[model samples]
Target: MTDLTGLTIAEARDGLAKKEFTATELTTSYIKAIDSADELNAFITKTPEKALEMAAASDARLSKGEGGALEGIPLGIKDLYCTKGVGAYACSHILDGFKPEYESTVTQNLWDAGAVMLGKLNMDEFAMGSANETSYFGPVKNPWRAKGESVDRVPGGSSGGSAAAVAARLCAAATASDTGGSIRQPAAFTGTVGIKPTYGRCSRWGMVAFASSLDQAGPIARTVRDAAIMLKSMASVDAKDTTSVNLPVPDYEAALTGNIKGMKIGIPKEYRVDGMPEEVEANWQQGINWLKEAGAEIVEISLPMTKYALPAYYIVAPAEASSNLARYDGVKYGLRVNGDDIIDMYEKTRAAGFGSEVKRRILIGTYVLSAGYYDAYYLRAQKIRTLIKQDFDKAFETVDTILTPATPSAAFELNKVVTDPVEMYLNDIFTVTVNMAGLPGITVPAGQNDKGLPLGLQLIGKAFDEETLFRTAGVLEQAAGIMDAPAKWW
Candidate 1:
């Protein structure tokens, strides 16, 4: 049989339904792919035994014609999600060897839908950093490369493993989280599809916290339809998570009609940041042209609050991160470093456990939340976040959706941006507004740059309106027709 590993979720599901291959065969194919692709460092843990066992059951169910939506699909779980008994470190030293007794709600939902877990994928330490360099497990290398270049480039942050794995075909899809572009940025870099549903669409129970308000769970998949199918299972209202929206999850895959006729798509002028690469700008214009050809009405709109998104995000996200990460004291279940006294122990353990980037954010977070500066920094950032949301709200009043370049440039070399924290933070410039506004946004691989690296276009939709984003992204995916896989080197 042709390489089953390369087939998308929809193709795999259809193949399984037709009995062309058993679930065990599909799972084994992915295992072999994972073994061969280890150089990418995509997975931190491999659950092959568990995956095969589940696949066998799925085979039996398929024989009985009773398979679930994702029956027999093998997937990678981002290390941030707690997978009962599997090591659930958020790629941070502080949570070393920590395994939760319960599975994250999102992963549990995937399991219920018959998706088999291949293993835990690597990510940025505590979901910090923009280039995946902060990962204690080491940075994930992007599967794609610039023309004629051999030096490995970074897969985008936090969800870097998810993007790399999906791009490399190590797994059918991966569960990823977004806090300031973790999902979308990596998707853009790796030329895969990623969507961050509205803030409350997916329950956050059992997922490690990054920034309570901004962190959200989503999927990184090989195609727009795969992402829609994965997200349908991942999203649900949970009594355990108060922030989860209590609404029925729609059939997102069904929403991809590929008929976006007369759709009013807004082109945000503010996204045309100074110093933007010409290739990136050209790619954005190409996306606009593609949509216009598909009968989508292009409209220019101004999001006046765009300039404040990055600074405000830095303040609010880190401030909340500080509060969430405070639980990793030496007294907890993870690593501990001893000191002369309890206070000394807390200081020593934290100082030893967290990475430099984590330390920097924590210090900044603590400073903003400090009694004297709370109003001046954290409070003001919160107000700016409100305005950012308002800008999108007003724009949506006249447009069905908004489009922008997913990233300012293609993937950069590892440690290239890390040296300057500000430059690294700019990676999320085009994406953080979606999180701040609590709206759904998707990144579709639109075109390739002069160097042959992929560049994606972003689509922002109304709150809890992921269906529209999926539909629009599907149209762009068809119009762009740029689904070429990276040349194999690993």
Candidate 2:
């Protein structure tokens, strides 16, 4: 029995290098685990034969003494990332049958590092929903039960499948995207560590764009070090993306130190909103105390314009998404619906392809970006976004990292939030600021709420300083320990 569940990528790589397990054995175990976890609805498409073939090649390379760090390490690439010859559908009716010839930089980078592709996981349509229930394929059920409950609950979205799959050991890790908490939210919900690297740290080329300015690729894995290893492998410079940075990539796995001596952690005073749950607040305060015990200095700070982040992001992200998604007419790519005329074709195509929430965002975005309203809305949001970034800049000058809740409330019931659009958007209250600032942010499993569902403490870092963010998160994760909330879901 290959029982390497919850093993970090670094651990797996070393074991593979030592010939403790052949790539074929590892891939076979994971394929079986994924098959067994079908009730979770975590996968949209799987490539078992392709995975085994890749594993055999990796085994040969190891035999020839030419194996790479990630040779044959199976990874679940989120459906949003384009994999060559693999379905790159975004769990939407829109991009049905969409397969891209070119590999997304993130996917290509992972392939270059020698990871075997397990399959594409499911997600919310256009990455719009807070819960995975909005995915066209179906919701990703949390692998853990809700406290003492019996019913299978949803893992968060739109990277819900990746989080659930990783938690359940379906893949060693998953490549997930975070625009407004897609990666972090699901990670928190499923008791896994997920990171959203600084904007452009991982190239966006080949990633199906949801919100161009905010969408960034990152790793979702079991442990902090595992995430670090996978993140290093997935990041690279690409000529295809205009925003790509040509900077040297860091050895993230090599940078892990379990010590946080003299590290300054800032606690934003304003994040203690009036409406916060008592248990959540206590968990956060406990996390602050844990960092203090870990030899970190806790300082009070303020991100004054934080209140505007959610509204601003809702406006800006949708505006960008609206423009980017305009290209998906039924004629060119994806699901097509015929109509009587050209205008009718466009309308019919969109109606058939886009989910209701996606359509709602498109309408909101179009309205906000309308010529008469651009200055009043879109431009103002842009200016606010700049201010949000500036707030982080000023705060980072005083502290090495900022700590906040990953989400305002723990994972809510399915569709409990979907009825009210604003309520659902508010689920991202604690996460949107990091994206707005274009800085690195990570969710560390903090503790459970009174209901005892998992909660995560978020740490924000300087631009491109995912090193610091992970280092700090690794410290917290070890101290806070694993979430025991809802065990039956597993």
- Name the best candidate (by lDDT): 1
- Model 1, residue 196: displacement in angstroms? 0.3
| Stretches of model 2 off by over 4 angstroms after superposition | 450-452, 482-490
lDDT of 2 by residue, 1-490 (tens): 4486545687788888888889899999999888888888899999999999998999999899888768879999899988888888899998899988888888888877889999999999889888888788978888876656766767888899999898888999999999999999988888889999999888998888899989999989888888898888888888888787878889887667888999999999979888898878888989899889999999999999999999999999999989998998888888888889888988899998888889999999999999999999999999999999999999989999999988877777754535577977877989999999888899978877666678888999999888888889888988987543234343
Q: Candidate 1, overall lDDT? A: 0.94
How many clashes would you count in candidate 2?
4
Candidate 1 — which pairs collide? none
Instruction: List ranges where model 1 is wrong by over 4 Å.
Output: none
**What would the per-residue lDDT of candidate 1 be over residues 1-490, giving only the tens digit for each residue?**
9999989999999999999999999999999999998889999899999999999999999999999999999999999999999999999999888989999999999999999999999999999978888898888999998899898999998899999999999999999999999999999999999999999999999999999899999999989999999999999999999999999999999999999999999999999999999999999999999999999999999999999999999999989989998999979688899999999999998998999999999999999999999999999999999999999999999999999999999999865734578988999999999999889999999988888899999999999989999999999999888487799999
lDDT of candidate 2 at residue 399, scale 0 to 100: 99
Please report how far candidate 1 places residue 359 from its true position, in Å. Answer: 0.5
Query: For all the candidates, what are their Cα RMSDs to the real structure?
Result: 0.8, 1.5
